[model samples]
Target: MNQVTGAPGTSRPGGRTARVREAVLRAAGDALVDKGIGGVDLAEVARRAEVGKTTVYRRWGTVPGLVADMLAEMAESSLPRARTGALDTDLAALAGLILKTLADARQGPLFRAIIAAAASDAQTAAALHRFYRVRIEEWAPCVNEAVARGDVPEGTDAAEVVRALSAPLYYRFLVSGDPLDAGVAERAAVAASAAARAGVYA
Candidate 1:
């Protein structure tokens, strides 16, 4: 077994693998935030991580592979959706979380860089798709619970509900360039809840 660090059973090189991987990931994310996908270089990442170039190459295989692994790591660390036992509260919480994440100074720019990368690279696009899918799956349970509670009718598309909660935040992040306030989360939840009841998600 790879002796682990930072959350146990998550390392491959004694207690240092997790730290080394996190360093590389942070370096890669910083590079992406500062220079976009076009500027990410494994050697530079190795230098930033103080790890050998061969180590990065051996672990990730290539740039796309590294990006995929980075995204997967992010998924592993993502917060679980709250179970408020009420559609409005649950969705509001979800929306708030989404807005907050998208508004994060480092995370936002890194994600935008990843989005740009996805536009031109098939592998990156696939990675992005997988990332979103994982997020949707993680949040879908709340919607299903809402349906079971009769807050929304049966057959509601749970993934769509989750997407609705995230949409406006992403829009404001990508376009409005405004602060993602609590008001946005409240309104988004309200809107999504209404739409779900109206069978928009059916």
Candidate 2:
């Protein structure tokens, strides 16, 4: 009987196996960007990555599995939160990051595809939520620092403040089809800061 190994390309953390995983994930991202989740096929992804189909199947097993791994990688690679020494500035920095991502030519469509996939796939939805959770955790410190500095109320919910900063930008990107611009980012930061200061999140 063939020994089933751990997810292909993930068993080893580094070296040639790591490189193969990176290539496969990059190819997967490109495929998701070019064509929605439905367009991502294991055989085609392997071909694009120049890896063997058996390797891809052995590792990812299914499209949702591949997507979950991709989101995990993305969470790992996400930028660190801003440490600007003030609530407003830190919020501004966070808002700017979100704006840049949502407005990006490649990332915009990729996120749209991911969101669409999550709507129909429970695994993908869980992965997407986990990704956001990681990101929110990264930024929560800013709000906590603000509380320490008395910039916001003592009972303010740092995570909710962070989420508030991002909600409008995502709304524009995925709901209203409004433009995502610096002004919008600035407003998001300012509004979230004001609300936090008012103990709206307490």
Candidate 3:
């Protein structure tokens, strides 16, 4: 786990405290994207956010701690899973959401930078894992729903199915450099869904 939220004088979950957190996180994201994780610092984030440096230092004790909190914030801010009553539509919606996030101008590079950092930093890696765990758990229910509805086999691994749906998209974003589009996202959904139906994940 990361450091605690803050020291004394921290406000409860709204109002000025939330605004300050938002500003600092936005600044942190900007720094991460513009100069990579190596270039991020509490002071710089405070300056960018136009908040007091002491606030940042007190709230987040270290760089990894700060990164962890940033990821937690991201998880909290993400949209909830689709309960569209059909696996195909739910999977397609998730794939489209992943596509939009990975292809975004700011989010793409930011993720790239953070992923790179996670390769070397254990704390960042753990944080990344937690982030994915939250997201996967959020979407995994659709696979379970499919199983219940007989759309896929019984005992299909829900989290694996969710991961499988995003694997190719991440491959394109991180390795293959393939173009990401609505067509590609749809294909990924179709492929993963087909595989699940065929017991590939059973």
Give the Cα lDDT of each candidate: 0.80, 0.85, 0.85
Model 3's alpha-carbon lDDT is 0.85
lDDT (10s digit) by residue, model 1, range 55-149:
88888766777777778777777888787788888888888888777878888788888988999998878878877888888888888998888
Cα lDDT tens digits for candidate 3, 18-118: 89988988898898888878889989999999999998888876777777777777777788888899999999999999999898898888789889989
lDDT of 2 by residue, 103-180 (tens): 888778878889999998887887788778878888999999999999898989999999999999999999999888
Compute each candidate's TM-score over C-alphas: 0.90, 0.92, 0.93
Rank by TM-score, descending? 3, 2, 1
Q: Which regions of candidate 2 fall more than 4 Å away from where they truly are?
A: 1-12
The candidate, 1 or 2, that scores higher on lDDT is 2
lDDT of 1 at 98: 82
| Model 1 spans with C-alpha error above 4 angstroms | 1-14
